[model samples]
Target: MCVNAGKDKESAQPPGCPVSRPVPAKPAQRPERVSLLSYLLRFRRDILSAQPARLYRAWMAEFRTPFFTSFLCNDPDLVNLVLTERPGDFPKSGRLFEALQPLLGHSIFITNGKEWERQRRIIDPAFESGRIREVFPAMWDAAVAAVGRLEPLADGRPIDIEPQTSHVALDVIFRALFSIPVEDRTASAVFDAFRAHQASRPMINTGSLLPLPRWVPRWRARKTKATARIIRGLIRQLVDERQADLDAGRAPDDLATRIMTTADPQDGSTFSPEEMADQVGIFLLAGHETSAAALAWALYLMALFPDWQARVAQEAEAVIDPGRIYFSTASKLKLARAVFRETMRLYPPVPMYLREAARAERFRARDVPRGAQIIVSPWHLHRHERIWRDPDGFDPTRWDTPEGRESSRRAYIPFSAGARVCPGSAFAMTEGQLILAMILRHYRVALAPGHTPVPVAQLTVRGRDGIRLTLTPRKTETP
Candidate 1:
């Protein structure tokens, strides 16, 4: 029987299944305003708080500045047009590159036109569906290791799960890419430096928003630059070592090896050592940080809804053998997968994606000038009042319903969509589901007393103070 099985249906909807769901901490209500200064100030605190509640219903909204015009698109059709149909006309904003250049340096995340195309061509094969299956064992090993680490920490004390998830995600990336665990000193150093770098940089810096002169110098704090240098140096070391291993014919067959050797089909060009470092930096940052944010929020949601957690645990026991998780068995974790998907809809990791118009375009009957900033916000679209029914509620079972299926097909884009969609989407989903199942199989998660997480957008959407939860060992009966 499920955790809510014994009570009347009305009373037993689910634990924490009030008429309303528990939303992460939101900013206090403020009077509406359109001033750029106000937006900048509010954005520094929380990106969600920076926008007006009206965006939840507006199909499209525009903001004009002395430097550039910006548009926020909420309509699904416009979103599809920008992301899928006419993506070529909307290149990644130069302002985004300016802000991230110190750390990312021409990475695929911030490139445009032919440069972006060439990089994707070389990188895409490493993330193909078949390649993901080849890499699943590494992910599984990391998930098992994470469960082992958590076992001793399941002592019913309030624990900040964000860092824990980050650790596990980094471990997974390292193992998948280099055939090494994060415990390796160079890997550990890069991980530590990344955390420091993220602390020093906001997701949307002023340079990306404000119109500043080209020579104004986008100021980066010394600490941020130092950390970026340290991170890049560590990655370069790994790349050099991998190159030496390849030359000697002893290289491990992993992501790094595959990427370094794959040449552009059109030109037979390969990534240079410096270029390889940039790509690795992005893979580590994007792959781990986003996955970490998703996992932490998912665990928090499981804690908030114990009945759902119980169902996930039961499913895990039925499908996953004790002390063993296999790539072949991942498809059996249906309930866990639904829970993970719902968590993403509520707390998308990369909350907003920014692009700039490459040429004049018309969207929703409005004239958009070339160089205008285009914002496609997954955060708003996921909870759009006009799109989602019970938009703020936590109901994983909705996956089984017609409305839920329709909404997912249309509005759900935790990984964004179209040509530039995240290549590792499949890998991320498999990893998240595996970790959720492994954790739930051995533990019951609950929120700490009086604890609430405030959602903030740094490089990824994360709890401002951190997500605190209590874990207790679960006693499972043999099937």
Candidate 2:
């Protein structure tokens, strides 16, 4: 029998209830089953709203749709086991391949099996630890060039940092790869085409959850073709120039030249013209966009957290000399490195990573059926309650502590993890810290009045309207 509280009829505990306090009545429920389309639509609606992560969590709790299936793996060992331990059993989703095929077309990021191994053999040697220092001069040159361009900005005036960071990142990619500066006309045209392509890449919501044919996206197809033509043409020009040089036995030591000369050990093969175009396309898209997004977010975070910003500035001051910034000095600024790590934790440029079950598998006693699409989102992993202390709070000091270091590396994956992890990860980290340090050496950045940087997950995680900050030159000349 139910018992009402003496004060109010609804406040009393029910008879035979385990707890002394009244059990609240459950909400009324509808008997109707939600269709897959409607469910996907609802999920999309939640993603578009603010607090997308929360929306993602709630959807994952219910059904395991294609979208959620990929996003629901917040468990640590489970993710590790899938991505690192037994990667052979879990490949990138075929659906994802289908979606990006027009743009990427069997690129390293999406391919698997013998083909992926063959590509890795050639690319891995180029990005190994020993060659990193060899590329240092190129990185330094690009950083200095970028900072010089920003020197003309009015002190204490607000500047949109995306374009500034984009220029620097593009410059780095250009100089490192082509051994040439990025021309304004070329940069403008290429960036414009990419922007148009990004916009045309289809609205990623419930629609992405549906298994639809590729030809259904007419506008997207057109944009893809146009973007491919513009960028591929540029890539072809660079490749032809490098190939001609290589054939003449006079190729330079730049990345383009290296890629042209390097052959796969497994197959003793070099990239064909079409294959080279794809590789260059990856470098152009993944290379610049990831770095630019991270640096932009890092700057915005610096402005938002002035204490950390001040610490970074102080570290830069100690390491960088007046009138000149050196790449070797970047090694001495550990605090700045920690702050960059924390910023990445708070705002990873890429949010979701997708994989598919190649065959039936078991993960922690749960059956992962064959063909099950799996998603591992850094967005959720970085913020999971069990993985971090004060997960929601912005605290750079957390990274300095031993617990923070272990926890972060285990949970924090701004560049992702496993075999398919971004090859440009180290290059990006070095570039980001160096650029941030160089920029702070010259100017103090603060959030502009009435400006709020809102995080949005687009092709990359970026500020919805761009990060705007006030840049003021430091007073007192130190010669």
Top-TM-score structure, candidate number: 1
Residues 17-95, model 2: lDDT tens digits: 5333221111122224666666455434323222234422332322365544543577777778778888888887776
Candidate 1 has which clashing residue pairs, if any?
Answer: none
What is the C-alpha local distance difference test score of each model? 0.87, 0.69
Query: What is candidate 1's lDDT per residue for 352-457, written digit by digit as tens?
Result: 8898998988888899998899999999899888999888778788889999898888889998899999999999999999889988998889999878888888
**Residue runs of model 2 more than 4 Å from their true location after superposition:** 1-62, 65-71, 184-188, 202-209, 212-221, 322-327, 476-479
Q: What is the lDDT of residue 64 in candidate 1?
A: 80
Q: Can you tell me which runs of candidate 1 are displaced by over 4 Å?
A: 1-30, 213-215, 323-325, 476-479
- Give lDDT: candidate 1, residue 366: 95
